[model samples]
Target: MSTTSLTDRLGSLLMAPVHLLMRIIDIPLRAVQKAAGIGGMAAVFLAPNMLIFGIFVLLPLVINFVYSMTGGTAFFISERNFVGAEQYQRLFTCTNYLDPMSCQEDAFWTAVGNTFWFVVLQVTLMIGVSLITALILNRDLAARSFWRAVFFFPVLLSPVVVGLIWKWILQRQGLLNFGLYQFGIEPYTWLTDRNWTFIATIGVSIWAHMGLYTLILLAGLQAIPKDLYEAAEMDGTKPERVFRRITLPLLAPNLLVVVVLALIKAVQIFDEVYVLTGGGPGTSTLYLTQYIYETGFASTLRNPGLAAAASILMGLVLVVLTLIQLGVGQRSEKKGKR
Candidate 1:
């Protein structure tokens, strides 16, 4: 046989099994399509994913809500007694909301306070710093790729590793203290002082996670059409005016996403802070996630029900944030159409 004939023969042999398999699959699919119609076929295709989501997401959410309504520390549902809304009541039983010490669940309230402040400060700084970094990276800088990699490198490190590295540097006997000693300054306990420890958590968290946000904003910055900037330059528009009018308006959608995501992540801050501070120095760095973890599993007087209740409350905050994001997005869309 000629070369073309040999190739065609091999191709036929290779595709024979694949064609047979397709034919086998097509029979049932066609039968189902005939039985169900187009919309039903779409639902049939989506059924597996919906089933998986129900099993993993919805089921766990239902179970968690159920657990929040029950009393006792027992891990199993059957061993626990239902005490609906009591755990939430305990959390709310405070002489003053501002004063965590007056709360029945003092630690929970303290965690809430810390989390609220942390979210406010951390999200603000995260957005600001990430925006700055992204803008700089988007410019025609020397070794631009290298600088991008440098900024994003920290994001690749595991949160545990981030905690350990910062811990070693911030510890009294660590490199930071050693450096301070070299400068003839007295070594200070950065991770122990309540104010300093809280500050350190914020700083460390920003350092650890800011890279991802920077990358996000950088992508947004790059996506803006260069033609707009060129046109503005030709019109002798000031750089600030150009940025404010063209860049900011275009980047608003990405900025909105970054803001909401950073807000959620800041509220859920845990792993690195936990490993670094252990919510210590009199619970100064204590956050909601750590409080839940400790309450559910780590505390000597473990209260899974309380933890579940707290988690549900936390989930409600997240839901509110999500709703705000949706509302803002719809408003933006309406403005865009106008």
Candidate 2:
């Protein structure tokens, strides 16, 4: 061999030990995998993702539960005194359970009251308006795609942005007020007053979120067999009768989904309301989430234990609500089957 070629060949040989070490390691892995079979392979592949979920999701939930059972301003679990259910009891303590003024944590009860109204109003209007929008869009309307995008655009905007945009327009001396002034109507306190603020938040919420739920209902509307509508048309069924007899029955599942999801969102609602009103004029818009946040993070008395307890209670209420809804849905399905 030529000297240069021989030198190059010797340099390539230096990698042999590294390659051999990898091969040695891979041999046992391959053997174990082959012996363990397909289930083992799946387990191996899934281990990383499962570990991530355990660390991020499960671990935080466990820690929150632990926090709820403890007392003190201490950050560490071991350092905090184990108070059992005292935190929960603190929340439930009241002279008159029905009256928020009688509660130890009056703010929490007030939040609960306000939230109940918000949920009732918001979910009602949301479903009603979204269903109407979906019905309109599902038809051969002019500029259909444009209108759909116009509605869906709000859903894509950040909650903060949605709040800020509405707040600006509705604020004193803002767009609405200016328009009203032009029409010779005196400017009104849109965001400052409790009643008006509640109305504003509910309206903005419906406008912002209706699109996503509209799309959901639209999908459900489309999924109804076109042939069914054609059959109804041929039979000379009135529009309202066709809708009641056919469309609504078929769309009930999506409506349920929309209602349940809207309920949950209304329960956990904070960001938009917080940005818009800061729970304001005087905690009128304060939601359970805001109450929980103030309890844990915002106040000088940062009681994580109490906040955790409140969150846990909120979670329980949601769970119960969901279970009841699911049970009803399942019962209806079984009835339909029969």
Top lDDT model: 1
Backbone clash pairs in model 2 (N, Cα, C under 3 Å; residues 3+ apart or in different chains), count:
0
- Deviation in Å, model 2, residue 283 alpha carbon: 1.6
Please give the range of 10 consecutive residues that has the lowest summed lDDT in model 1.
Answer: 327-336
Which segments of model 1 are wrong by more than 4 Å? 1-17, 34-37, 331-338
TM-score against truth, every candidate: 0.91, 0.87
Q: Candidate 1: which pairs clash?
A: none
lDDT (tens digit, per residue) of candidate 1 on 166-265: 9999999999999999999999999999999998889988998889999988998998888888899999999899889988888897799789988988
Per-residue lDDT for 167 in model 2? 87
Error in Å for residue 25 of model 1:
2.5
Scored against the true structure, residue 242 in model 2 reaches a CA lDDT of 96
lDDT of 2 by residue, 169-231 (tens): 999978999999999999998889989998888998898899999999999999899999999
